[model samples]
Target: MISCSPAEPVVPKEGGGNRERGAAPRWILADFDDTLAPGDSHAGLLRYILRRRIWPLLLLPVIALGGVVYLVPSQRRRGISLIWWAITLGLSPLGWRKLVRAYCHTRPGLFREAHRLLEEEGHRCWVLSASPRALVRAQLALQRPANLPYRTIGSRMHYRLGGLMPRFYCHGQHKLLPEICALDTELALSDSLHDLPLLGLGEQGWLINPTPARLEKARARLPHLMVKNWQL
Candidate 1:
């Protein structure tokens, strides 16, 4: 609903990916959860927090409430926020990055091809994730080569509402705000239908490990959508 100025654009590096000489660099947007990493970062974050706490059971009611609220389409965002608050209730910002990084180190697996694509300089890849910003960065640092020439944008995990609310949700069509539109998108990669707004942007679309039904729905609108596989 509100307009924002575009972000500082990323200059393309020559000899990147597979582009012909003088060809425009392809712009790519990829999801983090279930796309790059097989596990959901938010779920992993909550699990990490719960295991460290003395009595995680105290947080159960709030978490349950969030799950119930999340079933309602209109209240899903707030529901997720409430669940985040519950997990982060007593956790301070201090040493959180270390914790997040530590958690990433223990993650099961990342899709090698997806991670490789992000590292490629031929195309400009932007990791547009719904996961918390710091969490995504921590995960990326463990896997991504340093200065591989890519960008990451993620949800703002503000501590407001007792850590329940976000400054920017960065989910669904909200990912297509002015700041993102500033970049030229030639491809999109995601697992969820919620990202149809972003997937619609480019000529090429990739469905990361989608179910048959979901793939069918996506192909209905994006005939160019190609399936990318990552097995658990």
Candidate 2:
């Protein structure tokens, strides 16, 4: 799976490395997937579907429905029909969230250094993930020790019969800023090109999971921001 770590061009910083030091510490805005938790949660869900041998059968009907819909007259091809079809036939919220929570629980840390900092420094840490809050909270409970000091700021959901439908998913360039605004955090951490909005909101932003290309790109843009290698 492709890494969600943001490239340098997107990160906004003065130069390179940490500028804030001493007792005046800053809050951290962190992305849950890839940045903090290693690996793709969505990919794990897909793997589960494949292992269960359920995807092929589950998708077939959806495809058939889509084909049938496409065959309908343009006037009948309403947005509500598509929404209803997705609600009725596509991925169920229960199954999807189960996969998501399971995957999140199993995720390894991408940036140990950053996590250590958050733990040691006692920063007001909040996980800003595209994932639902329940999923993040569950993973944190399962994977990280209860002693770990942090809270999660994530997407909300709505409960349905035997499932949960996502009301909104936090993503794209604009996603993290609102989280930062709501949380009032000064620092942020992420590992993706799409997290620039969140990164820019930080007084000090750290880019995790650096590659040769990504490192160079980040250096060119956010020179002051620290770029840490996750493997270390």
Candidate 3:
């Protein structure tokens, strides 16, 4: 293996040492949400809109309409409940995801660092997640790192009639192992126990904040698996 430390100082210069060593090439695989961003992007967006926009614009309006409905008699209020329900059902999920993606531009520095390190080491990198592609793509666009490879594999929704029609959640062998095999990644890094299939594909694997029970369990399941902490 090539030395990864800095080279020795030329002519033994004072207070100086050799140039820093470079690392070997390895593929990087990451999970989104808690692994990259500080928190759940999907939830964060919903909470922000609920607290800032939806509650006030929707709940307040509905409540005000309800109070007036009692005074205005039941005839005019026939469609008011239906209208309120429709508004709530429509605006809630839509507004929340939009706002969350906007607010979730701030991803974790640790994950970014890991990404950079693996990339600089000339490893292929990819994100494997269960999040929808729209959300993941939005976040990835914002967190574009110069040194890292660009690839995202995640859930996607099929739309019809101007609304969500089908939901796809990327998990199990469908999500993890396939990507690992396709990329031929030598190493995989992840924080969740569900990433076992992906980790098994790697020549070596690193788990972040792995619980003791999970570690033991993983080792038992993957006898040849190599485990290490993800410093970045």
Candidate 4:
């Protein structure tokens, strides 16, 4: 596991970060897996469920189906959902959410920078992920009793194919966020190159989990990028 803290970046003086209470919320976006946290949530959940139950093995065929379906570029979300449905056969809506919450509580380590952003005042930061919304919300709940505030947008659970599956996942670079479409983004943070479009929305952007060579490449293009170290 890697231990990391946020690198302080220069924020423009007019908006975002530690602003007045009751003021209109400043928007920010954060990626979860491989950005704020280290790994893939869906994969993690599968392993978690597998260790506790025999069901995942019984549903291996479904995962195979998902694997085949995942080959198509546009149907990836649907493919992933099929795999999830198989892994989560026994859980109802509430049960699934409780499991997600429990999984998040058990795995509490996140990049220190993630906490700093949450604690800052006046920003209505939204943690965005391709992971399910429940997974995102559960992790945010772990920061409760303190922190500035938080919101989440991820793959939403909708009843489809006779089970609760992710209906709309935030995947590609141009994924639309209707909630913040009208507002000005103060900052954007993500690890993937696909998110450059989203990063452009913010006045400032932080690319998380960059390799040293990759960071150098980015700095060559944009010299002012901030830095933080991680202990692997």
CA RMSD of all predictions? 6.0, 8.1, 15.9, 7.3
Ranking by lDDT: 1, 4, 2, 3
Least accurate stretch of 10 residues (summed lDDT) in model 3?
Answer: 4-13
Weakest 10 consecutive residues, lDDT, candidate 2? 75-84
Best by lDDT: 1
Model 3, 1-232: lDDT tens digits are 2111223111110222333567533456667665555456644543444455444354466545644663543322322332233233445466546664666554443465555544565235777776656666677666654444457777664443333312445543446443355454555666666666666556556666667887887766555555545443
TM-score of 3: 0.58
Give the TM-scores of the predictions, in the order they appear. Answer: 0.82, 0.63, 0.58, 0.76
Say which prediction, candidate 1 or candidate 2, comes out ahead on TM-score: 1
Clashing pairs in model 3, backbone N/Cα/C closer than 3 A: 4-21, 5-21, 6-18, 6-19, 6-20, 6-21, 7-18, 7-19, 8-18, 45-100
Better of 1 and 4 by lDDT: 1
Q: Rate the local accuracy (lDDT) of all candidates.
A: 0.72, 0.57, 0.52, 0.66
* Residue pairs with backbone overlap in model 4: 6-113
Better of 3 and 4 by TM-score: 4
- Runs off by more than 4 Å, candidate 1: 1-24, 147-149, 161-165
- Highest TM-score scorer: 1
